[model samples]
Target: MTSITIRNVPDEVHRALRIRAAMHGRSTEAEIRGILEQAAKPEGRLKLGTLLNSIARDAGGLSDAEARRFDKLRDRAPAEPMRFE
Candidate 1:
């Protein structure tokens, strides 16, 4: 296992870390490791379609007419462009 050293941390920051470690019932080193691990990990990506489908399912699904209306609205021409000049 590799090790790292973080130097020049402000007293206040160190104190805060100590307090947080005590609150979580861990050593300062373990607390820092946990924080680093959480910060370094990649978050899972949620697909919009999957999320909407889940919500729709929980809400008992959309009516056929509502789906058709959404399809028509989605098929409409693009809106006019805004000039920044």
Candidate 2:
């Protein structure tokens, strides 16, 4: 898990967070995490992978053998840095 530091929150905002956490039976940290998640990735948000899969399905999906063939052609080597003239 990654951790982040938030600095310089207003006193009123901090007090409101504590009150909201108490009301929801969550710790202040938990409440903040929930708030951040909802703000960033709310319910019913369009996801890239789902959208791509839907597009593929609409275009006549590839067979398992064809998919495997495509996968076999993928480049496994690391990308090289570009040269500057």
After superposing candidate 2, which stretches have Cα over 4 Å from the reference? 57-85
Top candidate by lDDT: 2
Question: Which stretches of model 1 miss by more than 4 angstroms?
Answer: 42-85
lDDT of 2 by residue, 10-76 (tens): 9999999999999999999999999999999899999665576567656879665765665588667
Q: lDDT of all the models against the reference?
A: 0.81, 0.85
TM-score leader: 2
Residue 47 lDDT, candidate 1, scale 0-100: 52
User: How would you encode candidate 1's per-residue C-alpha lDDT over 32-68 as one tens digit per residue?
Assistant: 9999988776366575655775677569787657655
Relative to the unseen true structure, what is the Cα RMSD of model 1? 12.4
Alpha-carbon RMSD, each predicted model: 12.4, 6.6
